[model samples]
Target: MSAGVESLLALLVSRGGGQYGYEPVSQLAHALQTASLAEAAGEGAPLVAAALLHDLGHLVEGSEVERLARGEDDHHELRALRLLKREFGAAVVEPVRLHVQAKRYLCAREPDYLAALSAASRASLAVQGGAMSADEAAAFIRLPQAEAALRLRRYDDCAKNPLAQSPDAGHFLPHLRQAQAETRTAATRPDSPSAQTGATS
Candidate 1:
């Protein structure tokens, strides 16, 4: 496996057992559940990989997360995006990058969506800039990855159920390897339509 894949597996298998902020499930549980949902929804490989690794920044951000509980924004999305863009392409990385913003966008665009968020999600939403302004929401909708990011955001919101059974992290390795392969191959053949990500965030 590539170093990126190896490191991610280690992170998920080792540290992923920790609590995922205020969520009832462990980080690994949430990740597995998220990826499982994406797969069951018939999402493509890149999107499934995006679901699996969206919160990788949490594993990498460690102490910074403490700040979030204290009402600070940790900007974990950017951190993950920087690392992920090196190994995956825009299709994978951008959705992960925008997932948080997706929450804010939904809150602004749909009041019912905000009301439906878990208390923890609502709390973090405030720290994450709360609802977007009408202008901001308009601009956000135009982003190339906006729709994918919104889908990822939906999966993320639902993945926190402690009772939801999810496949083991190992079960998703093939998906990861597949995404990695496509990303590398796409780098060499930039015109290839199957490329999942670009070289930079």
Candidate 2:
């Protein structure tokens, strides 16, 4: 396995046992559940991998309790996306980066979405920037991965159920390795028209 993949697995094993902020499930459980949901939805490996690692930022930051205690947004999406970009293709990383924005976009477009959020999610929504403005939603929809991010966002929101059953975290090894290979191959194709522009395109 690549170093990045090994490191991520280790981190999940070591630090993801903690509570997922105020959620009823553990962080690891949430990740597994999200991946399970994505897989069940017929998403490909890249998306399933993205679903599994979406909240890795919270584990890396190691301060959810503290951040929420101080009412900070935490911005775990950026942290997780940074590390994801180092080892995974754009397909696995873009949704991680945009899932938060997708949440805002959904709230702006679907008023009922706000009411369905857990109390903690609702609280974080305020700090993460309340609902998006019409212009913001329009721009967000233009992103190539916006729909994927939205799908990931929905998985994220529902993955908090403590009663949900999920495969062990190790089950994602195939997906992660596949994503890593895709990233490594893409990095060598700098002149390719389909090559990523080194941003969340």
Candidate 3:
């Protein structure tokens, strides 16, 4: 496996028993559950991979999940994006980058969305800049990855069930490998469609 993939698996497995911020489930459980939801929704491989590794920045930050209780943003989404982009394409990295903003976007457009957030999510929302203003929401919606980020945010919110069963990290390793390969291939192929937009390629 590639180093990025190896790091991902190690992080998830090592943090298997650790709590997911203020959620009841462990970090591994939340990651697995998020990926499961994306798979069950018939999302493509890239999206599923994004779901699996979205919070990798938390792993990058080590104990930042604890700092959330103290109101630190930690900027996990941005951190994960930088780390994962080397291995994955924009389809994966962009969603993880925007997932936090997705929460803010949702809070701006969907009247009931904020009410559904867990207490912990609600707290972090404030540190995350709270709901976006109308102008900010309009700008956010125009992002190419905005819709995907919103979908990921939905899966993220619902993946906190402690009793929910999720496949082991091993089950998702192949997809991670595939995503990395796709990214590398796209980046090197100037004639490819992704290359034209300079998005992931």
Candidate 4:
């Protein structure tokens, strides 16, 4: 495995067992459940991998609880995307970056969707800029990977069930490897469009 992949695995192994803020499930359980939901939805490996690591920023920052205690938005999506973009393609990074916005979009567009969020999620939404306005929701959907972000967002919200079960993190090894390989191959292609946009495309 690549050093980047190993590092990610190590972080997850060492720190993913903590509580997911005020959620009912542990961070690892949430990640696994999100990935399981994505896989069951027939998403590609890149998306499943994205689901598996979406909240990695919380771990990377190592202060989700502290930040929430102080009433701050850690902006985990941007942090995780920046860290993962060097080794993972846009298929994984973009969705992570947009998942928060996807929550806002759903609140604006879907009837009663906001009511479904956990209390902690509802609290975070306020610090997350609250629900998007109509125009904001409309424009957000136009972005690349917006749909995927929405799908991942739904999985994220639903994954908090303490009764849920999921596969171990090891099950995602192949997906991470595949995503990293795709990222490296794209970076090597000087003539490829990703060379211009980088992994954020």
Winning candidate number (lDDT): 2
Q: Write one digit per residue (lDDT tens) for candidate 1, span 1-201.
A: 667776776777797878888889888998999999999999988889999999888888654348876779887777777667656777888899999999999999998999999988898888889899999999999999999999999999999998998888888888887887775444533354433454332
Candidate No. with top TM-score:
2
Question: Candidate 3, which ten residues in sequence have the lowest lDDT sum?
Answer: 183-192
Regions of model 3 farther than 4 Å from truth: 185-201
Q: What is the C-alpha lDDT of each candidate?
A: 0.83, 0.86, 0.84, 0.85
lDDT for model 3, please.
0.84
Count clashes in each candidate, considering only residues at least 3 apart in sequence or on different chains: 4, 0, 0, 0
Return the TM-score for each candidate structure.
0.89, 0.90, 0.88, 0.89
Q: What number of backbone clashes does candidate 2 have, counting pairs of residues 3 or more apart or in separate chains?
A: 0
Candidates 1 and 3 compared by TM-score, better number: 1
The lDDT-based order of candidates, best leading, equals: 2, 4, 3, 1
- Tell me the lDDT of candidate 1: 0.83
Q: Could you tell me which 10 consecutive residues in candidate 1 have the lowest summed lDDT?
A: 192-201
Error of 4 at 178 (Å): 2.2
Task: Report residue 94 deviation for candidate 4 (angstroms).
Answer: 0.4
**RMSD for each of the candidates:** 4.1, 3.8, 4.2, 3.4
- On residues 36-143, what C-alpha lDDT tens digit does candidate 3 reach at each position? 999899887788899998988887765656677677788988876655765777888889999999999999888899999999899899888999999999999999
Better of 1 and 2 by TM-score: 2
* Candidate 2 structure quality by residue, lDDT tens digits, 165-184: 88898899988888777654
Q: Please state the error at residue 175 of candidate 2 in Å.
A: 1.1
